[model samples]
Target: MSSDQSSNKKKNNFTIIKDDSTDGHGGYGAGTISLENMSSIIVDPNEDKAYVDMAAMHARSDVERRVKWINDREEVQGGKLYWIVWVTVDKNENGPYYAGVAGSEIRVNREIKRAYKSMAEHVKHMEKSLKGHIIVEHMDDHSKKLLGDFLRDYKPELWENSTEELTRQLF
Candidate 1:
């Protein structure tokens, strides 16, 4: 395969949903959080689109590439806003669903090679999503719609099985 294809394959691997690591085994990795069910969604309001970009799981999404991170949001003036949403899937009595969904804000300015995002907020959102919390209410309407459409189109069944709160908030 060509270099681009090989790189794409590697990027795709980040989105694979794995089986629970603990699985009630009570040994080795027991009591620890399992990220197997989680995926990252990158929402770009400027593009009016949302899509899964697993590399964001490590702050390496395409928009984040080649940028130095700045803690002070003011430093990244004119930076474009982006949302890194952490979505966790789990199966209930009905079926597999979007159990947890949280969106974190990020701003990037490629021209200045700087980006702004709170590491603490991102970490907190990821943890909340793992615990089945929905925290996208703070996102702008356009971004929310994009996220809702992406989720529904990505997996109709999952969207159907998700809680009404998710649909209500996103819509």
Candidate 2:
């Protein structure tokens, strides 16, 4: 595909808020959190780029697929840093916006086939994002900019509708 087509396809991987699965019926799945609004954004600081990678939702993104996970960060010395950002979209009176954004860190050493990431932290961040919290303060400036630019360029309307907090932190 052409560059524009490729870009569009990458952008299309992001998930937008959808109708409630429970639909106010309050039945079997009522209390469960709906993930339709969430998308996983992978930020690769080494490459200075970010993109939505839906496989990341299941810990199967390209950067993560072949590595063996290690519990200790020290074990992954010289590993490249990456961020899996959970971005949740929601609609307001004005339009759809990025209502939640939380970044979780991961370090990978491709040559050694080793990676370090806290599953607990990732789960917590996901929950926090689902609740509309912004938790990207831990990310580096470059990765933050990459994420911000990706979000803005992928869908300008959503970025424009996002809160000042998102803009202020990302920019």
Candidate 3:
């Protein structure tokens, strides 16, 4: 095979075709993007596991409470459920990097799987005196609303009950 054909074969082996209609180009355009090349899709399990550990290390009571609150609400709606929300902390950053609520442990695991690189980079910008730490925060009302909005927009299928149904049931 020619070098160009070999390169094409290698590229084709790694990525699946993506439909980018909702991605602002109208639909299938002249050129397509590859999902595998996306920064978020970390392929190495070991690297991902490391990030999950980093996330767990900072799991605080309040964070647990937040996870519980949402999990409780979802469970009441019935069927198997496992959901988690995480925050990534850095020494210099002013705000918590809310990892977002994940529907499953695996999904949550993926969020942190490739975090070490960025976390390490953040450390380089930190002062010598302050120590960096990671911790999980309980979802406050705002965070809860954010999660609700995200689920509605991105993962509506996860919700068996609508907000109206939930409010009616709870209240």
Candidate 4:
């Protein structure tokens, strides 16, 4: 499109405003996305306490293990799912493709406003998928508790971005 048309498109509808610091190759850094949006912390596969606990639980009797599995799975599915919607300069493109967990909600319109709040021009070509569904497996109480603790203490940034209702449900 012509320069005039491009400018008009931005003015008429929402478009990504590039962040001056963005390196143009997905270098937006972990800072741009809120902590709530992160699906999980990367635990040490071998030495993590949560991993050790989960392994023990998975070996239990069938019925007992099944119940625990279902409850744990619901934690993420029931909470607000988030992703980054990368919109290209060309409006005709199908994406702004998604890059996050499996169950991220695909509805575009619902999250547009929320996404704009944290958006930067470097990512203007892409929109943040603020609302969506995420697919994750069951984790044990130890895992959940560890994560909750991290959020409550180490990663408090998400607290302000999250709604009280979401905080209760997630944490």
lDDT, model 2? 0.91
For each candidate, how many residue pairs have backbone atoms clashing (under 3 Å)?
A: 0, 0, 3, 18
Number of the candidate with higher TM-score, 1 or 3: 1
Error of 4 at 13 (Å): 34
Q: Top lDDT: which candidate number?
A: 2
lDDT of 4 by residue, 1-171 (tens): 899967744432222334355444665562463322222222221233211121211123111232222223233333222222221111113332222222111111222212111223213212222333222223333433443453344335433443354344335
Report how far off residue 6 is in candidate 4 (Å). Answer: 48
lDDT: the better of candidates 2 and 3 = 2
User: What local lDDT does model 4 show for residue 57?
Assistant: 16
On a 0 to 100 scale, what is the lDDT of residue 42 in model 1? Answer: 90
Pick out the ten consecutive residues of candidate 1 with the lowest summed lDDT: 8-17
- Cα lDDT tens digits, model 3, 1-171, are 899967744442212224354556565564542222111111122222111212222232212223322222322342221223222222213332222122112122222221112223222212110122211132233334444443343323433233343222212
TM-score of 1: 0.85
What TM-score does candidate 3 get on C-alpha atoms?
0.19
Predictions ranked by lDDT, top down?
2, 1, 4, 3
Question: Candidate 2, residues 53-90: lDDT per residue as tens digits?
Answer: 88898899998999899999999999999999999998
Name the Cα RMSD for model 2: 2.6
> All predictions: root-mean-square deviation over Cα?
4.6, 2.6, 20.7, 21.1
The TM-score, computed over Cα atoms with residue i paired to residue i, of candidate 2 is 0.88
Candidate 3: which stretches are off by over 4 Å? Answer: 1-138, 161-171
Question: Cα miss at 154, model 4 (Å)?
Answer: 2.6
Worst 10 residues of 3 by lDDT: 35-44
* Regions more than 4 Å wrong, model 4: 1-40, 44-131, 134-137
